[model samples]
Target: MLRYPAVEISKGPRTVPWGTPEVTLDVSDVESCTTTFWVRSAKKQFIHRLKRREREESEDSNEDDYVPYIPIKQRKKLKVRQAEKRLGRIGLLKEQEAGSTSEGTSEGGNEGEEDEGVNLGPKSKFSLLDQHSDLKRKAEARKETAREKILKEEEKILESVAEKKALMAVSELAKGIEYTDPIKTGWRAPGYILKKSEHEHEKVRKKYHILVEGEDKPAPLTAFREMKFPKPILHGLKKKGIQHPTPIQIQGIPAVLSGRDMIGIAFTGSGKTLVFTLPIIMFCLEQEKRLPFINNEGPYGLIICPSRELAKQTNEIIAEFCGYLEKDGFPPLRSALCIGGLPLNPQLEIIKRGVHIIVATPGRLMLMLEKKMFVLDICRYLVLDEADRMIDMGFEEDVRTIFSYFKGQRQTLLFSATMPKKIQNFARSALVKPVTVNVGRAGAASLDVIQEVEYVKQEAKIVYILECLQKTAPPVLVFAEKKQDVDAIHEYLLLKGVEAVAIHGGKDQEERTQSIDQFRKGDKDVLVATDVASKGLDFPDIKHVINYDMPEDIENYVHRIGRTGRCGKTGTATTFVNNGNDETVLLDLKHLLIEAKQKVPPFLAAKELENEKYLNIGGEAGCSYCGGLGHRIAECPKLEALQSKQVAGIGRRDYLANSSADY
Candidate 1:
């Protein structure tokens, strides 16, 4: 601190006196100096002053015009305001220009002035407010015109719809009138007989709950003898221990014998087969006795069954009666079984040898007819046994085709356990002045059969079936919904050391025939089958029917249980149900049980409260469409399914045709 000067420090660049030379210092001199801090501060000040001078000089040389800083947001707002003001000025100018042009055109009434206005310079390309207003008005006018046109089209469509509805109503009324015309037609019993028994007929019908519908319906018979069967036929009936005519036979026989087309609906195992069979034989016998049939000359009666088994059974019955006729010194009435899975040569030979009656299934009969194997020219009696089943199996088209082959007016008899409204409608179209014989409600379970419904899980169904079998003795019928299920049940029963035989559509014809024959002869204890056996196949001694799984359709369920409780014999039917079953079918089953006065399970009874609306819909008059107790004709699933199938088939055919044309 010998002779050091005080250092002056500032926040900005250090100032030096003007015209003063820059000072330079050596590192060695500074290090030797005792007051090194003063020396370093002086040196930093001199270097800082030189740097500041250089920066000023560079900025002076590179500097551009000065602009005041403004925030981006404020700049943007200012620009938007300026643009709005410019648009306002432009709009004002356009309006003023339009007004001036209009004034000029109005003030100058000369044609030259108007021509000049129309021929304006190309510079006047801008649109005026008046022009814009004119465009908007024209657009609105177009929209209004379009709306009026659309409304008119809608009115036309509505009028067409009304006209179609009127036509439909007129057609329905005409159909009603035609069906109800009371003029008696077709073959009928003698006036004296019908008149004498009219009062007794009413009493008999009332006593048996027989519902007869038609114009001049024939009187129902109270005894088999009233039919006046041949002595041989009477003996055959007595041998079979048939004491009196069943309810179906009481009305059905009389109607058919009177030569009237008939729709006979009765409970299963109620002697429906006999109802048609006896009438067909009587017709055939009368034809033979009148004029004997020569080679390929006659098939006076034709019985069309849905299943081969049913056809075979019918053929056997006819043969048995024919044998009786032959033994009674009448000409032998030969009947041919024209079903599939048999020797065609034999059937053809029988046809060539002149047969009086023919029992066949739809498929084989259609084939025979298509091949010109036999003619139906002389076939006057047509019987459709299990008519509902035939329609359900897709034989409707075949039946219609067969109808085309008829050369004369045939007495068509349609017999079934259940008659749905759809079938009734079909009958109206197929038969003329047909008499309807109905015993009990259509699709109702037999009062003689005890129905048992149990909740069994899928895993426990097989085990539960064994327990179900134990409830009844041998010669039981176990019906399942699927062929695989039939096989499974058959396998399970055999493994459990039970004697069972199975038959399904998947089996060979020979195997199925053998199984049925064995079961019929009591060689097998249990018969596991699908719906193939549910139709009009009669097993006289079947004491129990076990439904391994309920059918989807309530009508099928009725038929399945009908296998038992036939011919006035009491039987038991046990159905296994679980949560997996369809609620609709379960509801139908519940209502059927309630109607039959059978005990319902807790789960089923619980659903009754929730479906109260459906419960009373078909109270006394069950579903007229499908005869289901849980639904009305409008909600019939079977009818809907058939309709949908037909529609889909039509659509498919149309699509295929279009595709072919495109190719």
Candidate 2:
């Protein structure tokens, strides 16, 4: 490096060395270096130096960049303190001068300006101590906030660890499940019925286990014959292959015959409607036989369904069933279907005609009740078909209001595939000390029906569904959330050469009926629908139930799948999922499957149910056992011993608790 003059640096104002390297600097009237220099060598050197000086000045300027300047108020205080320091020095100098002058004057006794009381300059003083105190306080506050944040992070970590441990425990317990003795089911697969038999119903009360203690009661056929039902009615039922009574008709007929308050829990397609309908028709016929009025207004029975589709279906079925009874000589059973979509005027006219059995939705029933369009005061029998679905969809209030119109101990028959707690509560409140009749397994996934749910990403849903339709080649029932989604999916399939039609709440009643009819007739192989199709639509060959969007609860899933594999047909349900959407609900579903001891998917084992080994799965919540989301423990086979430990503890606890407690 070339030798250069030593340059001194200071943070505060300080004197630069003179006479060593100062080329005259013109601060007052400085000109450009090119214009001010006289000698070329000196000018060249000066120009070079000027450039170097600029570089050096920039270097120094960056030094203070990190340190923010004090605010104007602080700067003013600093200046005031500096001024006071200067004034003190000046006063000291003046005092010395005054003493010297006095001595020189030999007692002249004249003090110059009377010393001005040693004036401290400026208006205020700056306290370095106070500034330091403020800085320390700020630092302490920042430290406290940081500490709190650390504690929260630790808490989150601890919670995550606890969840992991719990999941591991569930996983271990799942491994010991043995799957054998598979029952070969039939072609017509029905939904889950109550687990208890007539004798057992009185014993088990939890989780939808209804009991019907079958007595040596008069058979429904004997009752029909004794009541004088004609050969035409008996022949139609016989020709339709009526032998022994269905459990519902067996249990329900007697209760309704007794004219007492009753709640019957029967399986779907188990002649649930006829349980109450046959009795109502017989009773109405009996009333007609006794009264024999030319024209009378009566709503002897009210059957409530959750959906317009179900309402219409029930009405049609009842009409057919009762037609046989009518021709056999029960006063012709006139019925009106009260559901949304068809003009209410038609329903009103039918109601005005004095129908015996009114099949309606909760909302429509409430509206008819408010208009006083029908008389329900004389309604002796009340039936809530699919009562579980009604409560799930927030229709309890409306159902209760309908009940409010009817008085006197009424025979209420509640039929649902699965009974949730809410449904049980409703039965308790609405029905008198009723006989609980459970026909099959409580909360059992359909045994005869083979159920499979395919998890797919939302974005890939359309293609995945198309692939299934292409591969499976069976009548597919696709479900979407929105009416718009229904149209979109329908159009997409149509474009792909698949005959698909959309059905949703937005579709006019006729259009929905037509769409469903078209599918049923095999005119369309695939039908896209909303929750309206989730219940009470019987398509014998619905080979697949595609959930383009997952439902929020397990009950809906069960019902959706129940649409297919009906009459013993194996059905598959494909569900499209996205992150954060279906996790908890999927967990609930997995719990359902595990509780049922169904087969677990292998992917769930290696990925989902393992610690730190979760499948960003194809769907939501990591499995409770395997840490995999959107699948059951059986599906998550790989989550091993760690998960099992916690499970053993829980099992022991439950066993001890249940065994020790007195019922």
Candidate 3:
């Protein structure tokens, strides 16, 4: 597309050579030869016009262009015209003599144009067809009307029957639902409550003994019927087979319903799920009243958990309750579960279709946020279930970063079994004047869990589990520390002729979900797993919890054993604490056992006494001489010189005193 510049060469007047004069040039002829001068931009258009003209000429060169296609009906009409003309000469036909009414004409477009045998004498084709065709059409119309009427009546009868059945079911459910509203209650009003606030709080306190032990604990809501929850929520509770509210649910539901941030400190499986879920459903239904029903393109509520299993469990609970919502006048609730080891495209599609609630693990949710898959500005309810575990898993920063995405005033609820210093900081910064509900002792195991530890060697742990399995019933949960151990345990169980499945982080989401399903349905009587399945997974009817490999952290131990002994079901938790296998966590393990009111086995007490006598290197990092952290006593130059001086003056006795100052 290179273009050259136009060259205008000016030359002095000079006569051409001898042959130049022979060329004859007429100015008029030169001017007439030029048709039109096209601009640079219009040159292509000019050429196209020429091509179009040639194309038109080629198309018009057909020989049959003048002969129009006369249909068969028209051919018959022409013959009729000729006959009519002949007949008119004899005066048999009058008006049609001119052949004005030809085929395909306004005058000829009628049922009569359709040929019926022949037109004899002066009669047209319709004279034969009219009597039969009209009769057929009227009869068919009558039959169609009758069929439509019958179908409408049948549909009405079926619909009426279905309506009656639904009504009967609702009436039956209503009969069992318990509801009471003795007095008007308020968010700030405690004295006017139906039950004595302090007495009920103390009862919930003595039972759950929740965290934030020293701080204020919200008034506990004990009964489902007395709280007078919305009728729909009550039905949902009944559907879940929950007749009464847990201590956490008691304080939590009312606070959340009154529109305030709350941090519920209760153990796992204490029905903390319903506390947040009921409010979220109520909020969505309320929003539906004010806003037009639409695919909730963005979430109105968000629930974040530490692990994939917990997030999935919360998602199921949310979906279950949402299913119980009224079908009329509002959009159906939609929720999406996003976690690691799953397809991203499908999750994005769920968000695209719209979601009213999103239950997701921190890592997966953050990944989606990074990809801008969905907007979080619309989420008004933020629930951080198992907040302590989330921080332990290193999701603290991700949690804070996610909180930044909320553009509106959000209601943040942080539910944790124990609130540590880090969790306290997180709640302080994220929550808005939050009401704290402490059900049980902070950093303590549930009272319902019957805990016992074995002094079995590491290699004999599986043997101990086998014996326990033979004694215990089906539907037992066995926890191992690592994935390979979980797999080995599961394989061993299978080889031993026991039905079992293993779930861990190494397995994909589908495998994990399938394994969980098998265990849930009792298809697999035994479920071997790692800590991945420990938090927030509700497996009711879990008869026994066996720690084949004791958890390294005491918090995990609480969560692991919390699986069983849930919902007032007495269950046993047998932990295998080998003398040498788990020495590092022995001290914390003992303290946890003592605080939980479980008998610290003789071996555990011996370990503590032995640790007191022996050189403990894994003790809290601090100054060796002063027991302060951040520096070593041997590395201290002042202490080094002092020790050298003391060695000369006070001998080795002073050295022991210097090192054992805190001891």
Candidate 4:
């Protein structure tokens, strides 16, 4: 023990004492005391006291309000000091433990005295290793609990899905409709009627280019007698001068009669209407013979046409065949024609009288259905004539809405001269397991038609139309792009004393009907019209079709020229082109001519060399969409417009607005 010195302390404001009045120091010897106490200066002691006061004040204040700035190097130095301090404390504890163990064995009494002065906290008995192991065990238990929770949720979801499926199956069964796999059980062709050798069927299909896609397709019948039709139906066929079935009728009729959905694609006027007409008549006749339909309960078969004129024409064909059935002592099979621009009361009266077959356009038929005028309760046979034209006329939505009203499954038949990919996709979704019957290419021009292109000036086209008509005899058809053009051409031809009659969408239903009847009866030499007459109109002995101006779309061009060459009869089509027309349409026309093996004009042929790279890329001749040889599917304008319309949320428009008047 050592005593330093006694100092007097003052409590004045300016003068403050350093410590108490007496100072005591403890040391084993004076040498150690001098070395330890003399090493620290007064200035160092004063600075350490000031730093202690600053640390205490900072901790007592709110730390969030202000943070003291520290340089990067100073911060690093402070961290190093803290680490060293921690290591030093740990080393000191280790050294004390080692010394205590060694000294306790040698001097037990002295160790006991030293242990009495030491103090241990409450957690001194717990080892760090034991605490770490306990924490890890708890974490593993939490993970196992979470995994079990997730597994239970997934199992619940699966059970619910299976339950829903079972309920749906039960509901379908209660309705007496079991939905089978369309691929497996859809084919219903009679195997006994097929030929023995498959190669014989292949040869017939190859000769006619009749491509059929589906499972278990029916073999084509070469003669009408092999179809095993009723005598009355056969007599009707004989009356119409029928000898053999066309390629479409050969494949399409069997597929439809076997209760399979079918898509029939062929050139214009290859007897497409007869394919569906005969089957519907047979269906109606069967229904009538089994049990005659009472009032408001029949119309077991329906035919949906795109245009009024086509519907009227189809109704006439059905009426003629029905007449033959009645003459042969069969039940009276009545048919009704429902279309726009006509008296609704007369149509409704015919429907109320219990017709067997109803031919209707989308606008009028949809109106009747929406107003609860009639229902397709027993109508199991459905036919869509000119399906592509209906889509172009924007009846796609109405057709879908009509489909929703059906109570049960029905045999669907779609007949069109052209089948684009979009419509084909729609058919796939709409009809279950449909058989595709294609004669030649989908949009290819009729092989029987002779295409002639002339580069007539804008001012001289009207004058040149007379010269073109002179190439063929009377009963010629003239198509123009606009109703104004149709009117102009009709006046010019009448002024020249050509006995021409005009018809367009602007005309009344009665006037249009009269004009068509006059032209069919040979009372008018030429029938001038817009595109409304270009599709699904059958005119007998039409020797020449003259296009006063080129149509906008290549598909329209194909339909326009198809009027002349029909029913395997050869005819001529003369189109007038000029520089004012679109380049894309002109290019497509040029390629169409080349594909048909017709003469290409000098102006169109000149650009063939420049587009050589784009030609023959896929080794295919024409476009699969519109049958245009000038461009591939990537650059198709029709596809682009359709996609844009879809993106803009403008689906098919109303039929009356878009297509009723052909405006």
Candidate 5:
């Protein structure tokens, strides 16, 4: 029997009557507690001893009548916890032991457990793990597969969710606003709405495309706003009203920023300058913040352009970008131009003052190094702009000598309008695992340039050019094959009162730079130049490029035409190919014109048509049977035998006739 405790409350009669008015009750006992009352009890079953242990050794199980009770909190003991931890460790050890079983042994265990932290034992069944990989590979493999599947599913679900959320949010925002889409309204369903999965798939695709030979097409950048350059660089770009990066700049910038050696192959004026300069500025900014002060004893970065003007132009762009960066926390990146035309004393003083970057021509930079004006020990970034042109300018040995000072630590970026075997070998020796970006075909002109070919006598080119200039706008670039021709053309143009100047290798460096400045500033209407001004001179106003004399190579022709049609502006390129030695050039020009969708010349077609089915035999013997300079129809031995037989038959018939007459 079980007893229960209860409380009893007793109230005495009230002093005042309840029926009458104004009656008060004597409830002093209301606050009192009385413990005396009848108790309620229930019959309880009790087993004096606890339930017998149901151990295998002693089985006195009374499980039916027994009930188990537990406190909300668990009881802990050091020995029990130690035992549990030891058990866990033992379990892990067992897993490892199972994995480490010899391949020859037949130890059977789970294949799903982790196999690590164990040396292979002769007893383990999977001793060598397929005999290919080490101990961690199997676990890593399983984890990798599982992680890949999970990530794939997660990416799909997350993309779909995010896209739906974004689209629905846009729809919500547009509810109060007027929106009219001819394709998305009423019965029409756009691809983004109808085929939602297609749009969902591209969110996780790669950001960069691989450009390799035979598959050399790189997609264009649709917007510069999406690239999200830093504030300083964006400020510079905005000040210049540059809203988009050219195709080469789009791909080339990221590669350079990733700290990889690069070989950039793009057409001239395709914004290759910004490809190296932007990254160089950013690098300088980072180093500036990292170090207490920049050491100007030698430049941290070096830019080796082929010409003084290219170096000067690059230096000006760097200064512009650095000016924008100065407003922010970063100190402006100081740059100095050390080209040949400039005074060596000024350059030496600039080096003494210290510079973050030195933009110099190869020849001048080599001389500075020989004079010990600056050191290359701290210089970590080197840029070779117009690399192929530098090689052509006979700076190959100078470049190699300068690179010897770099000591394999510097990052070398080689940018060129063309890729020659020399550039290839130089890159192999200088750059370390470089990423090559060839935007268009190397040694090819921009499609933005409209090309026209005029076949005429070399002496009458001045007349043809005069006519072309009269028809076209000002600031035309005229390329001559020889310096004499350039001078003659310039003289004739001046005599005719055409505002023109000439530039070539024959001109002093100062004169060349001055002429280019005049051309760039529009002070001169026409600039007669050789291949010297054919590359990397950024004159935004050049509307026409006339090749007064055909170049020996199509590469030079491409560079000549590239002087115009810069940065998406349409311009014209006219080439004068004379009849004598220009036939070969015309042959290439015709194919190039046709390929680029330009107008093909009738003379090129007529010449090719005349020689299409026949080879020029000249005076050389080609075929002995027909005495033809070229191969005639194949000689047939069977036909010759048939002819001999016919002649013998005729002789036999005549002999028979004579014998009959004699008889």
Candidate 6:
């Protein structure tokens, strides 16, 4: 029901002679009242007559009452508003005064020669023109400066709002975390202060005899057999020079070899693969002698990695360790690699045929499942390498989907460097009363790696990182928070004659593998990487891990540094800290450094450590002598005195004044 506004009409009927002399009538009806008009030219005549009466009455009134004049306040306000609108329209409000001075010449000149004495000579004209030009440039510069200042202020406000929102969300998450159950620790190291007793070392040596002694006497194939490996493998190990089982393998192997589902909580590069793989290979060998063929029964051992590069590297490791079993009278082991960015049909073909071990990323395996190519139901042993990373990559849904395909009872081994509450919860639900093997702190910082963090300004990050790199030698693995940043840093380093390669999720499997190989083969001096290479990468020669960009989540910081200092080899990790305002990273860094027995440099402990201080300069703080910020003389209250001193000492102003007078 749409409604219309009511309209009023007036009707008038003309009195006319009967019949033949009939006249046409114009209708006019107003407020249901009738009006009659008898004269011709009624409209004009009525209007004129009415106006005449009104005009006569108005003209008879006092002249002073009808005077036209505006109040001073009103007139001034109108003029100010007009000026403001003009400035606003031109977008020159911030530099209006300067702009007016720039255009010094007037639109029209006087014809009379009364002002001829004020005219300039040739040199003065040139000087005046230069002055006008300088003024114009200054005005333009001021406008740009004002606009940039406004934009920066707006950005600061927006960042503040976003930070508040993030804080609220984190607070809610923390509240939820409070209600969750903590993971129970099963195995414990002997003492409050961890020490290797002579007898304990002996027991460890015997138990891990494969590392120290070349003989394999049912003792778990230790992380590194001290018994020198074959010259080639030994040479590689000797180059790395790691000939011992790390804490993780020492504790984790026994649980894994005995067919127990275990959750290992240790630092990255602590030989976690051998913890599961050594036992799985041993188990596989034992199974292969009895059952020669596992047609449609595999992939008997499935290792799911978060990224393709990791999957490929893990596959290579499997091949390397399986090579060791060949000399031990084991059948030739067949393994297949399946990941994205590769031919799916070939991967399906490889899986369709028999495969003892299948290493794959979550996405490709899910696609393979849709085609009915292979099933995880036949998988007897499952390993989620770098489980934290898998979860971090938003592959939880995909991982859960893959688990649905496995119906039979299977052993699940979950490994992660730093297990947050989320990963622990996933492990608790995913594993069947799993035996938890925590070699170091269950959920604490690694004791092996020497973690170092330096606070720097946002703009100073590149220079700081460059300076830090220049201080150190080669074999530094730099971790960036973004792929584009990795590419950028990689390019910049290359331009500066520092050999480097970039690796990220965007790279193809081959490119990623090649980049890792280059980093490993000493072909590239620096490797700039995103989080893709942060997990499960066993690069032993990594002397320094530089967090070129801080991780968004603090836990990623732990994993990025985990790349170096593995297997009793000491390594240093340095994180660039521009995110000092970030409560999580700042607090975590403080807590970690303090707990690790490292001196928290007073500079790092401060909330906002200025980059200028690191460069040996006073930053934004006002000077004690002049009470001036940003500049000593320009913004100082005693600028006149400073100018006098400068003029007397350097005579720059006197020279300028003399030039002005001469001109």
TM-score per prediction, in order, is 0.69, 0.56, 0.61, 0.69, 0.59, 0.56
Per-residue CA lDDT of model 5 for 146-186, tens digit only, reads 64564455345334322121111133234533222111101
Q: Extract clashing residue pairs from model 5.
A: 100-124, 101-124, 101-125, 102-123, 102-124, 102-125
Error of 2 at 66 (Å): 77
lDDT by residue (310-425, candidate 2, tens digit) is 78877887788678866655667777887766677777676666677788876667766787777676776678877765653445556666766764445667777766433454
Output the better candidate (2/3) by lDDT. 3
Candidate 2: where is the Cα deviation over 4 Å? 1-210, 213-234, 237-260, 266-271, 292-296, 470-474, 568-570, 576-581, 595-597, 605-663
lDDT of 3 by residue, 1-663 (tens): 212222121224533221233533333432433244422323344356557887877778975555555568857765675566566542433334335334312223333342222323332434568747856878988766765564455345334322121211133234543212111124342345645666665666567544333234445566765555556667877877888877677767767766667777777668888888877877876665567335536788899887777787888887777766654323577789887777777777777777778888777787778878887767788888887665434355667668667655677788877554334544554555667777765456788888888888877888778898865698999998777888889889888899999887666668888999989998999998887778778998998999987664456677889899888887888988775654545665676677677898887776543223222232423222222122223232323443465467742211011111101
Which stretches of candidate 5 lie above 4 Å from their native place? 1-228, 292-296, 607-663
Question: Scored by CA lDDT, what does every candidate get?
Answer: 0.74, 0.57, 0.64, 0.73, 0.61, 0.59
lDDT of 3: 0.64
Kindly provide the TM-score of model 4 when superposed on the true structure, using C-alpha atoms: 0.69
Best by lDDT: 1
- Which 10-residue window of candidate 6 scores lowest in summed lDDT? 654-663
In Å, residue 515's CA in model 4 sits off its true spot by 0.2
Ranking by lDDT: 1, 4, 3, 5, 6, 2
lDDT of 4: 0.73
Q: How displaced is residue 318 in candidate 1, in Å?
A: 0.5
Query: Which 10 successive residues of model 2 have the least lDDT summed?
Result: 654-663
- The TM-score obtained by model 2 is 0.56
